[model samples]
Target chain A: MKKVLFAMALALAQTAWADGGMDILKSQCSSCHNLTGPAPQTLKELWARKGPDLFYAGNKYRKEWLVQWLQNPTRIRPAGEFYEDHIKPGEKHDEIDPATLKPHVSLSKDDAQAVADALMTLKPKSDLIAKEKIEEGTISKSMGEMVFDKFLGCMACHRIEPDYGGLSGPELYTAGDRLQPEYIASYIRSPQAWDPKIWMPNKHVSDMNIQKLVHYLEALSQENKNGK
Target chain B: MGNKLIFLTLLALSLPALAKEAARDNYRTYCVQCHGMAGNGKGVNIRDMSVQPRDHTDAKAMSARSDDTLFKVIKEGGLSIDKSVLMPPWGDTLSDDEIRDMAQYLRTLCKCKFGGN
Candidate 1:
């Protein structure tokens, strides 16, 4: 029995190493990405030219989130990842087939784990992690509304009932019906978890302001129904 | 009475200078795809999305939101502010000052505010 247990442990460790082994990463992800540390700078520039920079794949995004996004190529960034050059209005753009996404490509559990593990090690040269204490404010309806529109710029992408700010983001008219307050707060603080290639402008909001905004956004669903 | 009127006129004329600067470049870099150049919400990316982007040019929707609400969404994100998972948080990419500038530009595109359209 002890021999069996020891064998099992060895198998698991070997399996773990096998999946993330540099060999697999080179075979799979190297075509688009460099598997080695300090990914090639020229590759970074080319990706930025064509799309978003993936050099910091590990530190910039969560593993679960990366799995989901890799499968579904949703336009998390309202604008193209690099730049927006539209000297004209109403120009036509091509669409991507949802079925053709990378996520749809089947991978063995081992291979998936291996790729996820390898990808997570890539970090950018710049420090992006925020460490300051965010100020906390009393969460209230009026204040939330104020912060949503005036202070924080929620209206830019979301459509909350009466006001629609911008489309580059998402529809917020039913946020209260859709999300939890804590989820809202965490997402507000760091959106990269959902998508590493996001093009949204990062505005450093204090924690207090984030709380107030979440409180107000969460109430949108309940308040409207109750006629508040 | 004349002097008072002149001072008032001067103040009114200079108010546009104090008016929040709009960082259109930020908007272009970050928002123009879905929101479009006009803030109509029909950006190049709209066609592929499951849901159509909201039209910001609509006065009815613009009037309901206050400037603070807009700011919150921009700084945190659509999901963070209970807006949408599709809209990622910009809090890390831009500064508060830059976001405010973008908000001011958004107001210009929509041609309306919290109360008036």
Candidate 2:
């Protein structure tokens, strides 16, 4: 009888303790985001998604970026997660009205850390990210720009500078700081695998070009950090 | 019957203007970032780009190109015409009618029709 009572108490304690991260996630993020696996496979499925799939957060984002972003959330996708729904006609460009935009829910530092920790555990495809060491300074800034702009035309959708590049995708100028090198390389290789209906096309870049692009992105991030 | 004919004529005259408006919206949504809000070459990306985006207002330069060429460039991207790869293919994004309208809108920006010279 005593053992049964003790087991019950222990179970209750564990539930309360483990609930810290899960509780925060449920209360805060579950409304708009899908925390489960199986990213949207079709354009129709993608449009239905309100926020980016966080199931692969461990494989995709850097822990530091996740922590910082949770505390002070910002809009990453310029055309929003669903461009078809978010973009409206504007004078200069298709714009999301500032007033109408739903601000990301910001959490306290402790909560952010807890959420980040919890999110890092959501590794659906553990084998997707390879153990590749990123060598910084592998590609020069000029060479990187040429590859990004002239060779691949990545600038059409991704912003390489704060003021430059397209608005449809995430800004790439700070990509070095924001994303894991492995994630960057993997995503560049085939974005469809990560998010099937994503606007980023599979350019069928060679392995060499993929490495060069990742190296360039790393260098660009360092350059931005140096305030140059 | 005469009033109806007049209404049809007015609608016919306004169709091009409506198409132009749609084209303008497409340009704003897709091209404004690299091409600049004023259709100038100095877009936000100018600082990062090795090759400058073409200035749409340059009549002298624009007059040299044919409308069909412009349409092809917009549809197939600069690389299709052996130009810079900086221009991405919009054929996947915009409809053919929209591209035709955009080509027409480009003429307005330069204020010179192709083959008029």
Candidate 3:
């Protein structure tokens, strides 16, 4: 049985090596991404999600950003994929592996677009997206930054820019362009609902605050002077 | 804090040889980065940190805060209690009971308890 499994794995790797895009998703991305259907129903199930669920990538990611990111991927989550994957003894403050994480596989432009196209078809939560509206101008830069950094304490876990915040959560500098507004609001409303036991706290964020945070992220994405 | 059973439990390694080990291991794993091996808050990360990590060895300081307060800071991060955001939450990492153990172990470090002042 082990021999058979090894053979199957070898075949899959060869197939992905020979092609890109959808083939890559099946053979490579499938190892981590849940590409099939319904999201994790429980905490145990959530743990199996080694990478962010691409099953609903269509609903979560912006297609243009996905295309660009696939061509030249960067680290989003400061700690590798999971929160406690590389936590070890005799280290400093929840260290994750080392200086930085290993780079993701880069693809050609055409391949990137192809993968993006394929991923965009996996939209499961259109209802959630339909209710989202980008109500801009409500949160000013200073006010938004104040709430994001202090009031709500998102900056502790999430980074608004490079090397600015705690290194436990995903970076949010490109969240405006990378993620859907509705997704952001929904996630902050309750991170555990999406990925139970995820490091991000619910914070019991108010409805107004959620909108403000989303607004902040959107504005931050727009105000890019440097760094990826 | 409780009846005789609880008192005996408390007498058992001051309640947490197991819990103490857990708290020590957790401190080593998480807090020692900034709190240091001796609970002196002179952790290796201090050089880069803008503010100093709290000195657990400072009996006067640690004693001033209540166990519930310590639990809150550990479980919810420093910002939840209007403290520094630099103190990241361990809610997702450590269990509630574990946090409680950590709070108790902290008492051992300072060798002091809250006087309700």
Candidate 4:
């Protein structure tokens, strides 16, 4: 009788926390995040989007990173969510008006945990993965930088460090900690496949170099943690 | 009747110029991030960019390319013209008429008409 009761308790436990998590998500997160989505299918939808699509957070993010970020909260996009939104003409060059940007909302620790749990349950694009197993392969520091800057020209937008690269894309120093390796590779391979109208171009990076890029991102993330 | 005719004539003359003026807004919105507020290729984002944004004000250089080439580049992307991918395609964002006006606006910036290569 104890064993049967324990079995029932285990089953209830699996759903108990998730129910709380789902409630928190529906209440707080659904306003900005697309919790249930076929990701913005048109340019109009893309422009109308308020926050990053969380429908695939399970496939995209690391849970620990998500929880920590939700509690602390930071601006990921240097030029705001849509680069065109807050831009104004300055005397020298066009500037992103700091006054116009509203930072991501921070949640309390308990709320963050529930939100992260709910987010991790969303994996809409599981099929978008490496055809073969991909690992974080090695890349020489110079060669990796060359591939990022010269060969591929990712420095035109993405930044490896703070205040370093172009402002249009998200900072990449914490990419490894923030994103899963498979997610990174899959994204670089075909950004359009995931966010069809997203400005990130399909570079057609070779498989070997894709692994190298993943390794580079992981190393950069480590360097950030080490205070470099 | 004379005043009305004059007003219509002036409006007709200014229509193309008005279109170019309108395209300047698009330029300010999209291109100015990398192409500079003055189209001098000294955009704020150029500080870390390995490749420089093309200076629309470079008359001698701008005259070498035709309007068709310029339109293609703006619509398709720089990669479409064997240029850098840093100049992203605007086909999805800007309409065909807007892009055509952008090409026209670039001509105004250079102050030299492209007769073809």
Candidate 5:
């Protein structure tokens, strides 16, 4: 009878643990993130959003990255996600006090793992990222630089090298180290798909270019690693 | 009458200064990231880019270009001028008046006239 009771208790505990993940998400994350989403369609609606939509978190972020980031949160957007709202009339953005920025809520390792597991299950459009993959060493570093600087004008917003390029967007020099190749391709193809109000405009890049870009990112990351 | 004339002259002088300040503010908002805070072209992105952003403070280089060229580059982008595509077009984002103001501001940065004497 004790053996049977132990087995039953184990099953019950497992079920509760599964539910615990969802419960934690609803209680902690739903306030800022759109856990369920059809990303904001218009700029006005996008600006209204307080945090990045996580409905496609499974497709967008690596599970390991999510777990680590949850435990030790840092600002991803140098300028706030809605930069227009953050820039004061007579001050430089970099001059703004870091203390004034809203801090992201940190989580314990167990909670972060549970929350990441729950978030990974929230993938809605898996098809968008299905075919994207990073192929290593296909494009030379110089060729990738050409595509980034000359062809796409990406240098205007994204930084591929340290201290070079525009600062309006996230630095791309560390992107290969930081992002999934599929996520990079998907975001580049249609930034609005992930966040409608994001300042990045959809450049309608071709599939071939997308491949080249991912390969370039991987190459850049490798270069960064070597340089370091 | 003398006081009124002096007041009018000061106001006239301050108008350009005020406009220049406004232009500087606009530069801070948009160009400072890539162009540096002092228009030295050593922006934060300097390490990432292959081509250097134009240094507005370089009097020799700035004086060589015409105001029309500066206006065109700002409005249409470097691609229009056979320059690097790294400089994105601002025509859709900025008004004609703003571009003109920015060009004037660039002149102040270089401390040189655009047209050759």
Candidate 6:
């Protein structure tokens, strides 16, 4: 018991000294995310997304939300992963006693603000995709079909268009009226634990790409609504 | 003359198959360590990866894409293709032909026959 406690303390110490935390993000988060602009072309366009984006940290999220989320992430993907095994159902990890995590990510209050401020600057370069209208009758059923079949590999694990692919995640045919684009965008970039035991792989999508995809889905769903 | 025409058609048909075999061999030698032999993404190193590698056995999913997309993906990597950042690009290690061949082999696994090439 003593040894375990000591080990946790040591880990916390190491986390605290870890360059105030942002450096750790640079090294580890860069794999799936970018803090700057000119984002990758392959970045998820919402409709064809496998992960979420983090470009617009400041605008989309509140500071308290950011801090709490960083400390304890939740699964946000409704359908889970495209493949089954990656999204382990019902698996959850919470604050490792503050001591254990402290060593790895010791963020002072000031440090947290600086990091949050820096994250907010990551926005899309062009407003073409951003200015997408979500008015009724924008997103058509056919648009959903195109998104599911063409751009993003949604059919890989979903049943949105029917017989498109596997059933690893949930059905998205009704996402047109069921979900909000902002929520969809956030979930796409960072999947929180839907079931905790789910087996989905993290894709680390950026915010701008999510916005583009949201625009596509919103338009499709809006079109569906207008027609209805 | 008929025999010559038949021979040329047969060769043309078999050439891509041969190149695909070579690419499969190369992937087995290098990528199989992390990407798996069947491309189901269950390689030995897969367990240790933070982000799981893509499964090549996803036919419908893989079929939806273009050959150039797959080629670029293999040459540049998952990050380059805007997929997973875990997949390292083989451009530095493998030749262009090798990457093309690998893409060909991947198409076979996924049964992707679209996109004029």
Query: Which is better, 1 or 4, measured by DockQ?
Result: 4
Model 6 C-alpha lDDT per residue in residues B18-54, reported as the tens digit of each score? 2222675566544544455456766543432346666
DockQ numbers for every candidate?
A: 0.12, 0.09, 0.09, 0.18, 0.12, 0.05
Off by over 4 Å in 1: A1-27, A30-52, A65-106, A123-151, A158-199, A210-228, B1-117
lDDT of 3 by residue, A116-206 (tens): 8778777777777666675765678899988887676666456777767655567898899999888898788767555544546557678
Could you tell which candidate, 5 or 6, scores higher by DockQ?
A: 5
Share of native interface contacts recovered by each model:
0.24, 0.12, 0.05, 0.33, 0.25, 0.00
Q: What is the TM-score of chain A in candidate 5?
A: 0.78
Q: Tens-digit lDDT track for model 5 on A142-190? A: 8988887779889877767666666557777767766778889988887
lDDT of each: 0.56, 0.74, 0.72, 0.78, 0.72, 0.49
After best superposition, candidate 4 residue B97: deviation in angstroms? 11
**Model 2: residues >4 Å from true position, as ranges?**
A1-19, A131-137, B1-117
The global Cα lDDT (0 to 1) of model 5 is 0.72
Provide the TM-score of chain B versus the true chain B for each model in turn: 0.73, 0.79, 0.79, 0.79, 0.78, 0.71
TM-score of 5: 0.61
Cα miss at B117, model 4 (Å)? 13
**Model 6 misplaced stretches (Cα beyond 4 Å):** A1-33, A37-67, A75-114, A124-128, A136-228, B1-37, B40-103, B106-117
Tens-place lDDT digits, model 1, residues B3-69: 9999999988874222222376556666766676667876655543445555677777866778888
Question: Residue-wise lDDT of candidate 6 within A92-132, one digit each (tens)?
Answer: 21101222111123355655544554554444522432433
Q: Which has the greatest TM-score?
A: 4
Choose 1 or 2, whichever is better by lDDT: 2
lDDT of 5 at A189: 80
Measured against the true chain A, the candidates' chain A TM-scores are: 0.46, 0.85, 0.81, 0.91, 0.78, 0.33
lDDT of 1: 0.56
Give the docking tier of candidate 6. Answer: incorrect
Q: In model 1, how large is the Cα lDDT of residue B106? A: 67
